[model samples]
Target: MHDIAPYLLQNDLGGESLVEFEHEEGWDLIVVNLARAIDRHVRHQAKIDPESYDLDLIYFSQVKEKKGSLRAYVTMPDAIINAYVDFAELMSETTCEVTGRPGLLHTKMGFVKTLHPDVAAERGFKPVD
Candidate 1:
């Protein structure tokens, strides 16, 4: 997450700026805001569903210098890879639509694709056949 730190920091800085920094050089600030907006939008939609899809929204912190991994325990109704891909795409599109901007969703989609270890233990949260 080293790569993501700067943007997150920028978000913090911008939030603190009070002036709103209306015309900043970094578009990442906009993307970050858009992501937050999209997350809210998607979660609202998810809440309306009969099943919440067992989506566990997780966030964690670690030492800032080195890259760190995020761990999640999710049991998707579909196959693991497919669920990851579908969730990523859905989130990306939702983000873009909410933001009316491009590329942010696509970038987040790629991030989702890197998730690993979709094995039995992860899947065990679901009932056996």
Candidate 2:
């Protein structure tokens, strides 16, 4: 079975350390869930009356009204593109590189899931297929 990384669903980095190579400029954050990117979310804006409200209230209200963000899309690595196509017989939900833990698909925000070579092997995943 494919092994997902611990805290793959968490808001933080979970347990994995950041890798320098994985760090892309302007993308300091990694997305934790690929589903979140694919999931439909409505973009919204808030109307505020600054003159009628305190600074803190206006700030907090704006924060609460914010919606989820999309994942950063970058070119996939050769190994990862081949791996996902080979193992799942479909395009990957995201791309990733190895860190302290096993390599995993990710967004700029965080990890979505771990890619275990053993799982691919057991499933007879071929690069071409």
Candidate 3:
């Protein structure tokens, strides 16, 4: 999170405002990078056209994993930001949710997840068919 701390509103608002994630530790970097990218773009845009940028649509409202992928819910919609979100969500599909390693979808006893090959094998999961 330190990587993105400077780009987060929590730093300005104080008391843990921007740090929130409802997912495994592996995707931590993914979330951090995503936030950083989004924040950078918005701040840049805001500076260029202060009157057109809506602060309301600049922050994330929810971030969670659903069906082995990421869901980043922004308070409001911005077409450009949506493109970044879309890319991140697709990236999560091939990332391990436990170790941040390259991974693929697997299933263990009917539970589904994205995990590194080693992590999946150790956990008794097989590649999803």
Candidate 4:
């Protein structure tokens, strides 16, 4: 997986705490795609009016997998950026976090994860009831 931090313009690493990705490797592609979209969006807005969508106005504070879906904690406030995050979360729920294959939520014991059927079988996970 490629390092996504470089794509983020203002990740706000100085004041608070360092942001990090806590999801699986397969989801790295999803994050990369999202980062590019946000970068492009910010750049476009900067062209129109620099203050309209400044880079520092939004960024992910935390990214993690929870309950067979992606959870992104973004800082600052921006509706467009929030919508991008929402779409990414939806993609993560249907894509395997380990293999990037189309997937569904499965369970092993009490732990739930989004995984393809073959991968789930290999991991001893059962279909969610």
**Which structure among the candidates has the greatest TM-score?**
4
TM-score of 4: 0.83
Stretches of model 4 off by over 4 angstroms after superposition: 1-17
Reference-based lDDT, residue 64, model 2: 9
lDDT of each: 0.29, 0.24, 0.76, 0.78
Output the worst ten-in-a-row residue range by lDDT, candidate 4.
1-10
- Which parts of model 3 have CA positions greater than 4 angstroms off? 2-19, 54-57
Candidate 2: minimum summed lDDT over ten consecutive residues — where?
Answer: 58-67
TM-score of each: 0.23, 0.19, 0.80, 0.83
Which candidate achieves the best lDDT against the true structure? 4
Summarize candidate 3's per-residue lDDT along 3-95 as a digit string, tens digits: 563334342343345546788998888888887777787778889988766554345667888877878876445787788889889888999
The CA lDDT at 102 in model 3 is 91
TM-score of 1: 0.23
Q: Please identify which of the two predictions, 2 or 3, would achieve the higher lDDT against the true structure.
A: 3
lDDT of 2 by residue, 13-56 (tens): 23232322233221122322222221211011112433432212
Which lDDT tens digits does candidate 4 get at residues 20-80? Answer: 6888887878888888777777777779988766555566778889999888776654788
